[model samples]
Target: MDEVRVFPIIITKNKDSSEYPYFVEIPDIDGMTEGKSIADAMKMAEDYIGTFSLENKLPDSNTKLPRVEEGAVVTLVSVNVSEYKRKNDNRVVKKTISIPNYLNELGKENRINFSEVMTAALKKKLSV
Candidate 1:
């Protein structure tokens, strides 16, 4: 069996960019830091946590949150229960995926996710 560990995170507003007013991040650990802001950032954080939780088999338990201080706000975020359950039941893995040369070339040309292109192709192929 593998051991699992959980860490705390902090969110703060950027000093420079007012438009990007929030960040979700774990504290520095061995020099790994991926920061996010705005709605998309939160979503990215969710995906990141999902991956981390899956890899570490984080427990499906409510966190023992600390009491909030003055001038602080707490926002409740939601995730798909089925997705969380699936992550809890599986282990994260690293694997390389293969794509057609044309797909790869087009992705490079467009600077977009190969998955997005693949999804579009599949949709068109199936006449969806």
Candidate 2:
């Protein structure tokens, strides 16, 4: 099951630049990220919040919305922290496993990718 957290974000158009125009502010994490469009900005905000939540403890969503200025949009961004981490965390660690000598020799001879096989087996066993 995915644990979803919703955070409020303020998006404003960047008048200074046209290439990357949308700017997002995630107040809960005190984080800021920008994107090329509104949808992109929202996605970036979600990613920022997810990364922040994974790294640090996050406070409960603020019930009282922040004051919105003219031409600024306030919206809720929901992120599944667990799913986000699973999708975004790519750091790999080495693990030593003991396999039968014959199987190991066969795998080497067949040029099998042990990492891919292990990952697929684990994912299947875990039903992820």
Tell me, by lDDT, which candidate is best.
2
Error of 1 at 14 (Å): 1.9
> Local error of candidate 2 at 67, Å?
0.7
Count clashing residue pairs in model 2: 0
lDDT of 2: 0.88
User: How does model 2 score by TM-score?
Assistant: 0.72
Candidate 2 local lDDT, 22-127, one digit each (tens): 9999887889999899899999998898888767987876645689999998888888888988887878879998999999999999999998999899989989
Candidate 1 at residue 12, lDDT? Answer: 54
Collision count of model 1: 0
Task: Name the best candidate (by TM-score).
Answer: 2
